[model samples]
Target: MLNFSNNKLNNEGRLRTVLDIGCGVASFGAYLLSSDIIAMSLAPNDVHQNQIQFALERGIPAYVGVLGTKRLPYPSRSFELAHCSRCRIDWLQRDGILLLELDRLLRPGGYFAYSSPEAYAQDEEDLRIWKQMSDLVGRMCWRIAAKRNQTVIWQKPLTNDCYMEREPGVQPPLCRSDDDPDAVWGVSMQACITLYSDYDQGVKGSGLTSWPARLTSPPPRLADFGYSNEMFQKDTELWRRRVESYWDLLSPKIESDTLRNLMDMKANLGSFGAALRRKDVWVMNVVPEDGPNTLKVIYDRGLIGTVHNWCESFSTYPRTYDLLHAWTVFSDIEKKGCSGEDLLLEIDRILRPRGFVIIRDKQAVIDFVKRYLVALHWETVATADSSIESDHDGDDIVLIIQKKLWLTSGSLKDTE
Candidate 1:
């Protein structure tokens, strides 16, 4: 209802990524898939009987999380839309911190579609809430894009003009100049607005292309990382060739329906996920927290990912991914003084039985992981040298392993 035509919403790809808070069963996300939109359905792991599990089983992208104290794992400007349909979140609590978090995630000129009683109800309490919400969003420089029936959509400002024009000493102040909006790994949520960068100040929106083109086009934010268009193109081509080789290696060992949910443990520029566009599987690209903040570049390319540190466990539930791709992840974490065995255990916890793992790293890391294969109930599928000819050092190895299906004593009796 934001006056968006079908062409604009579905074809133009202006609204590619979405954040669906309190998504129950993720039916809204499932519907958006036909329009080439991917929504990250988020819900809390509460007494609601594992709603996120049902969403995952339906092949919809979902995560078990809440808008709590910590920032969502994603980087700033990661989503083009944020939706809440009777999500029951108190947006006015704690100086509107939750709504501010949404502001951080949304791209400039992004929309928030809120559907709740406060928008339409005439009761006194509902009116009070509606007034408070309207004032809060107004202070945040969000304007009502559209309102109909019980739903109202608010659009964030396209630039920092409104923020700069705000009266001095506003309630929700702009974030400090030193604040890194992209630093989200285990970072606390701030009740402040993140001003646009100097580049964004001059631009209207995120300066990103549409979906298919965005998948291959060099993102404007690449300049923030000092990356040239040539480097981005080369990275894309490299992943394309590497993915082809990966499929060739996996073709014999797996059926067509084997790999559905995939993850890149250390996604760099999201080229790995972009290369797999033709495949039926969906990749959860993960950019390491310690590395360059490339998650924004990943989002600008229209791929989904999060900022994460391999030292700790991922935020999802156990047995979430069908295939895990670790390229230099073990070595990188090792250099950071994290335990490789602990990481291996965490991987085993997240990978489903019979799932696959592709680890491309130094021979030493492969040897270190191989030592725990038997104990982890995993078997080596295959090992090969680096397919890329540029690996003259010859230390790079591709090790593929599969988690074996096993039943514990506590579950064996139930099966019988």
Candidate 2:
């Protein structure tokens, strides 16, 4: 089952609320929340009823309702998040309306995420249904995994923003519209029929939401490092754009391009942090870097203050991150629109002496990184920022530096 925790949901002090449609008996998402008020919807079945009752008995706010029913019993923009976990979407005739209704209930900009419905074998019906369901959601997408199962995420555009529907007159179409109510539901009905057909043909399986999981909130910005607000914002965009551009360049080089890029930076850092088994490593992280190409590894500050807040909830299975790495801190490397010796010095602190650092930064940052590293007494192992440059008067710099071994506690500069 999928869960949305404060980490993914946290945004500048905003209180969080979630609605899980096709919310089965176990209430997977509700249990992970720090607060209550999770809305639950389920199909009309004794099994579902017993599940909702169990959740309520355990003090989880739950309800029994059919998906897409007009009587959602909730007001406009009632929640900040609406999630679906292994909803019987493939087998429910009315799930189309349910998806639309979930959109209506979501505040503009609220997340509408669902993780379910693995692609069955290469059966004709399976592929057809897969295309139909995916096309129904806006082209916006994210993955929880790569194989048979996939998680899709989208957002209800804010009140002032418009959706990417077919252009009324001359513009190119960005995506196929699911505005046609009949067309949308028609595909869903067929999927339902297909699943039932399978069952009738002697296939049997329980739902996938039975497993339990927790959504987590990552660490807070600890003591402010030397970075400034202006620099932070600029670096954030720079890293994102650079990483995206790198993905574009690197795609053809790999077989599974998307998977490779995802593993390159942010996703890699996230998975790495989640896999922590050591106490010392648990406290380290690759945090966000505002500038381009800098990785955001590690919490905002030292791991000292964060362990307590994290332990409050995940005491038995606490979060552990030893070192920050990859695209997470790439922003810190690029220097983006920023250029400063002090800021450069801050970046130098993130590394453990003698540790290796891979940075894809702005062309301007190369000289700075070199100067900074030499100043910090680091030994350069290898450095290159796509040595080939375009004829255009612009380029980015890359540097690969490693903390070198020292025979004594004295600085490398002293030896030199």
Best by lDDT: 1
Q: How far is candidate 1 from the true structure (C-alpha RMSD, Å)?
A: 2.0
Which stretches of model 2 miss by more than 4 angstroms? 1-15, 35-47, 90-95, 118-123, 139-149, 169-416
Q: Across residues 48-111, which tens digit of lDDT does each residue of candidate 1 receive?
A: 4288877877777888785789998888998999999999889999999999999999999999
True lDDT of residue 87, candidate 1: 90
The C-alpha local distance difference test score for the whole of candidate 1 amounts to 0.88
Per-residue C-alpha lDDT of model 2 across residues 223-306, encoded as one tens digit per residue: 123545455444434444443444344344323311210112232123233332121122222222222111211211111001
At residue 409, what lDDT does model 2 achieve? 48
Please list the residue runs of candidate 1 whose C-alpha ends up more than 4 Å from where it truly belongs after superposition: 387-394, 409-416
Q: Which candidate ranks first by TM-score, i.e. highest?
A: 1
**Each candidate's root-mean-square deviation in Å?**
2.0, 21.0
